[model samples]
Target: MYIRDVTKVDIETVARISVEGWRHAYRGIIDDAVLDGRSVGEAARQWQEWLEDLVRRGDRLAVADDAGQVVGFASYGANRDQDNGFDAELYAIYVDPDRLGRGIGTALVRDMGRWLEAHGYEDVVVWCLKANPWCRFYGRSGARPVAQRIIEIGSRKLEEIGYGWHTMATLREE
Candidate 1:
C-alpha cells in the first residue's frame, strides 16, 4: 500500500470508505434507524466538499492506496477545540472493512504523525466513539485518554473519548 495526499481522483473511493466504514464501525453502537438512514451519495458529495476545503486550507488528508485503489484515509489539522492544548487533531480515520487488520490503519496513523510533524505540529489529539472497539487502536499507539464528551446523533446521545499524544515521536515505529 502507498500513502499520499488526497486528490480529486480519490474523492469517490474516500467517500465510499467513509460511508461503509462508518456503517461498519457504528453498526451495533448507534441506532439502526439512524445509521441505516445514511445516504452514500450524500456522504460522497459532502466528503468531496470537505476534501476541497481541507486542500484549500492546507490541511492534510492522506489515503492508503492499494495498487491504485484507495482502501483507507486519515484527515488531520489544527485543533478545532478550545484550549485543547493540542497542536493538531486527527479528525477522522477509516479503512475499508475488508482492509481492516492489515496494518493499514496503523500505517495511516504513523503517516499522519509524519505529515503533522512536517507541518510543525508536535502534539496530536483524536476523538473516537467510546463504544468503538477501534478506539483501543489509539491507546495501542501510545495516545493517552485525555478527555470525554457527549455528542448527539439523530436523537441518540453518544459518548466520545479523546486520546492525545503529547508528541508524535511515540508513533514512530521501532
Candidate 2:
C-alpha cells in the first residue's frame, strides 16, 4: 500500500471507508441508531466540506491506497483541547474493516506523525471511545492513556479516552 495526502478523487472512497469503519468497529460500542442512517453519498458531501476546511486551516489528511483504491485514512491538526498541552492531535484514523490488521492504519498514522513533526509539532493526542476495542491499536502505537471525557452524540453519552504520545519522532522508529 502507498500513503499520501488525500486528494479530491479520494473523497468518496474515504468517506465510505469512514462510514463502513464506524459501522463495523462501533457495532456494539455506539448506539446503533447513530450509525443507521449513514450513507456514502451523504458522508462524501460532508467530508468534502470538512476536507476543504481542513485544508484552509493547514491541517493534514493522509490516505492509504492499495492498487489505486483508498483503504484507510488519518487526519491530524492542532490539539482541540485548550489545556491538553499537546501540539497536535489525531482527529481521526480508520481503515476499511475488511482490511484491518494489514498495516494500512499503522502506515497512515506514521505518515500523519511525520507530517506533524515536519510542521514542528512534538506531542500528539488521539481520543477513542472507551467501549471501542480499537483503542488497543493506540496503545500498540506507543500512546499512553492520559485523559477521559464524556461526549454526547445524538442523545447518547459516550465515554472517550485520550491517548498521548510524547513525540512524533518515535513514530519513525518502527
Candidate 3:
C-alpha cells in the first residue's frame, strides 16, 4: 500500500468510497432513507468543493492506495469550527467499506496528523457520530472526546462526538 496526495483524478474514487463509508458507518445510527437516498452526484459535488477548498487553503489531503486503487482518504487543516477550540482539525476520514480493518484508515490519520504538526498546528480535532466505530479508531490514535454537539444533516439529526489530540507528541504515544 502507498500513501499519496489527492488529485482531481482521484475525486470520483474518493466520492464512491465516501458514500460506501457513510452507508456502513451510519447504519442503524441514521435513517436508512437518508443513507440510501444519498446520490453520487451530490457526493461528487461535495468532493469537488472539498478539493477546491483544500487547494485554496494549501491543506493536506492524503489517500491510501493499494495498487493504484484508493482504499481510504483523509483531509486536515486549520480548525473550521468557530468554537472547536483547537488549532487544527481533521475534516474527514473515510475508508472504503470493503477495505475496513486493513489499517488504511490508521495510516491516513497518522499522515494527516503529522502534516498538521509540520504546519505548526499544536492541537488537532476530529468529529464523528457518537455511535460510529470510527470513534474507537480515533481513541486508539490518542484522541479524547472533548465535546459533543447535535448536528443536522439533511433530515437526520446526529449527536457528534468531538475528539482532540492536544499535540502531535501525544499522537505518537498512541
Candidate 4:
C-alpha cells in the first residue's frame, strides 16, 4: 500500500469508500436511516467542494492505494474551531470497511503526521464520535482529550470528543 495526495481521478473511489465506511462503521452508533440514505454521488459532490476549499486553504486529502484501489483516505487542514488552540485538524479518516484491521489506518495516520509536520504544523486535533470504536485507536496514538461538543445528525445529537497532541512527535510510530 502507498499513500499520496489525491488527484481528480480519485474522487469517485474516495467517495465510495467514505459512503461505504459511514454505512458499515457507524451501523450501531449512527441512525440507520441516515447512513442508508447517503449516496456515493452526493459524497462525490461534497468531496469536489472540499477539493476546491483545499486549494484555497492549503489543506489536503490523501488516499491510501492498495493495488490500484483507494482503500482509505484522510483530510487535514487548518483548525476550523477558532476557540481551539490546535494548529491543525484531522478532518476525517475513513478506511474501506472490508479493509479494516490490516494496518491501513496506521499507515494513513502516519502519513497524516508526516504531511502536517512537513507543512509546519505541530499541534493537531481530531474529533471522533464518542461511540466510535476507533476512538481507542486515537487514545493509543497519544492523543489526550482536549475538547468536546455535540453534533446533530438526522435528529440525533451525539457527542464528539476532540483529541490532540501538543506535538506531533508524540504520534509518530516507534
Instruction: Report the CA-based lDDT of candidate 1 relative to the real structure.
Output: 0.89
lDDT scores in order: 0.89, 0.89, 0.85, 0.89
Residue clash pairs of candidate 3: none
Give the alpha carbon lDDT tens digit for every residue of 38-68 in model 2. 8899999999999999999999889998888
| TM-score versus the correct structure, for each prediction | 0.96, 0.96, 0.93, 0.95
After the best TM-score superposition of candidate 4, give how far the Cα of residue 135 lies from its true spot, in angstroms: 0.9
Writing each residue's lDDT as its tens digit, candidate 3 over 31-64 gives 8888898777789899999889888998878899
Worst 10 residues of 2 by lDDT: 165-174
Write one digit per residue (lDDT tens) for candidate 4, span 1-174: 999989999999999999998887789888889998989999999999989898789998999998888889999979999688998999999999898888888888888888899999988999999988878888877789999999998878999999997787876765
In model 2, the clashing pairs are none
Worst 10 residues of 4 by lDDT: 165-174
Per-residue lDDT of 161 in model 3: 93
Comparing 1 and 3 on lDDT, the stronger one: 1
Ordered by TM-score, highest first, the candidates read: 2, 1, 4, 3
